[model samples]
Target: MDLNYYDTLIAVADDCPVNGAVVPALRGGKKTVAVVQFDMISADPGGLTQEDVLFETWLRRRESDGLSESERAELRAQFFSRSQACLRASPLPKKYGWGLRFDAAGRVTLCPMGSDEYEEIIAGEVPGVNVLKAMRSKRA
Candidate 1:
């Protein structure tokens, strides 16, 4: 399934406690999904699609060091063969105070909560940009 969000901005969760986007830190000497996602997106803004981010994060965390190209392709197919949660459930927006913006081409970039871009997105000042909030942490 294609999981790209075009011309959309996913704002931070309402219950996010941080005032701005914070880099996700290593946990227990290992990179969590949030850290991986943050590192990938922050490294190259608008360079990756949501599917690329999710699959690469999952692949990196696995033991596929010597897999052949076909094997890797198979793995990717298996990974995406089932339903996957989108970025709205991601910790970057729900916990790390970052907004996710998808351009018309479906490439994604991180927008920190207090950044000018984030402000513009949430305020509906950016044309053709649909805004949605990340899933809340608490049940209300």
Candidate 2:
């Protein structure tokens, strides 16, 4: 995977409805927004060579389907901006690999950075630190 691809993925994920928007309250009644930003310039393609082009094409197609060029451009700009905001707002850990982890109670947990479901899980209103275990166990 290319680093640029990863960054683009993250950016796109940030703008997704599942990722949503987060508004953190700061001191003095102020609000702060954090969004995700991708640095595609530094990405290095490791194995999948066509990934970046494919993703770009998808975006272009979606933008061009039924809207004028200006409208499409505006939508794309908004999407990218929102994606950056979401990235800045969230604190996603660096992904190392893909696998499952088990808790002491023998519950299953999946830590996948590439999963589209990640944002939904994180945005869900659930209590308890072991929610992931419950979630995965339920899926099982």
Candidate 3:
């Protein structure tokens, strides 16, 4: 169960409303999945793999109070043991107008839509990088 992409850029969805990447805001007093994902990537661009991002997002939201280090590790193992959706379903690309670039090592970085880097990737100027669009928000 590996959830990593290499030398790839996940472009924004076709129905994305923004012209450029917009930082996701907290929902009420809580962090949304989009916010968590954005923060993690923003804090360490190209440092986290897709599995890291997804698991952290789940962990941050879970009530893990009083859990020991080994307990947390076990929980993490259980989390990834099940099927998980990839970043293509993530709101960063599907709604927030950001792109996800996975490097050769499968570490992810953000590419804001409408940015020069994003344009280069979309235009195939970034050699060896394949482009994939985020999943659509609505059915046809």
Candidate 4:
């Protein structure tokens, strides 16, 4: 995980939809975006970029995609910008009704939108923290 991917100030979005965008292409099938992201974030407290998760997912689907380490690194670098466009746009915040929160250490954790913690955080009642909602798909 990279520190660049960590944000001390978290994004908490409510009223979002569950859009299955980051799901891995698997042999039997794919898991939901929430399942993938949660597992990835949980594995490392440092947090990961959308690309990190996506790359892992892609590898899960095709380990023999055939790219050298250098090539893979280059592709991953390019993937950052590309992934940014998809990450915040993820269904985790866009539709799954989960709030993404970062600790002082910059690790991310999910808060169900229906949870009291989400309400307190969203209301700014939580001390020493900031939250931003996910962007809506269309005009409100």
Q: Against the unseen true structure, what C-alpha lDDT does each candidate score?
A: 0.91, 0.30, 0.92, 0.57
**Residue 94 of model 1: what lDDT?**
96
Worst 10 residues of 3 by lDDT: 59-68
Ranking 1 against 4 by TM-score, winner: 1
Candidate number achieving the greatest lDDT relative to the actual structure: 3
The digit string of per-residue lDDT tens for model 4 on 41-103 reads 667745654456666555544544778899888766765545344345555666555566666
- Poorest lDDT segment (10 consecutive residues) of candidate 1: 58-67
TM-score of each: 0.94, 0.20, 0.94, 0.60
Write candidate 2's Cα lDDT for 31-97 as tens digits. 2211111112113223222223233333543545667778756765655544232121222221222
State the lDDT at 90 in candidate 1.
93
- Can you give the lDDT of residue 127 in candidate 1? 87
Judged by whole-model lDDT over C-alpha atoms, candidate 1 comes out at: 0.91
* Candidate 3: segments with Cα more than 4 A from true spot: 65-67
- Which scores greater on TM-score, model 1 or model 3? 1
Ranking by lDDT: 3, 1, 4, 2
List per-candidate RMSD values in Å. 1.1, 16.4, 1.3, 5.3
Which of the predicted structures, 1 or 2, would earn the higher lDDT when compared with the native? 1
lDDT per residue for candidate 3 within 1-140, as digits (tens), equals: 56799999999999998888899998898899999899999999989999899888898878457878898899889999999999999999999999999999999999999999999999999899999999999985
What is the lDDT, from 0 to 100, of the residue 3 in candidate 4?
31
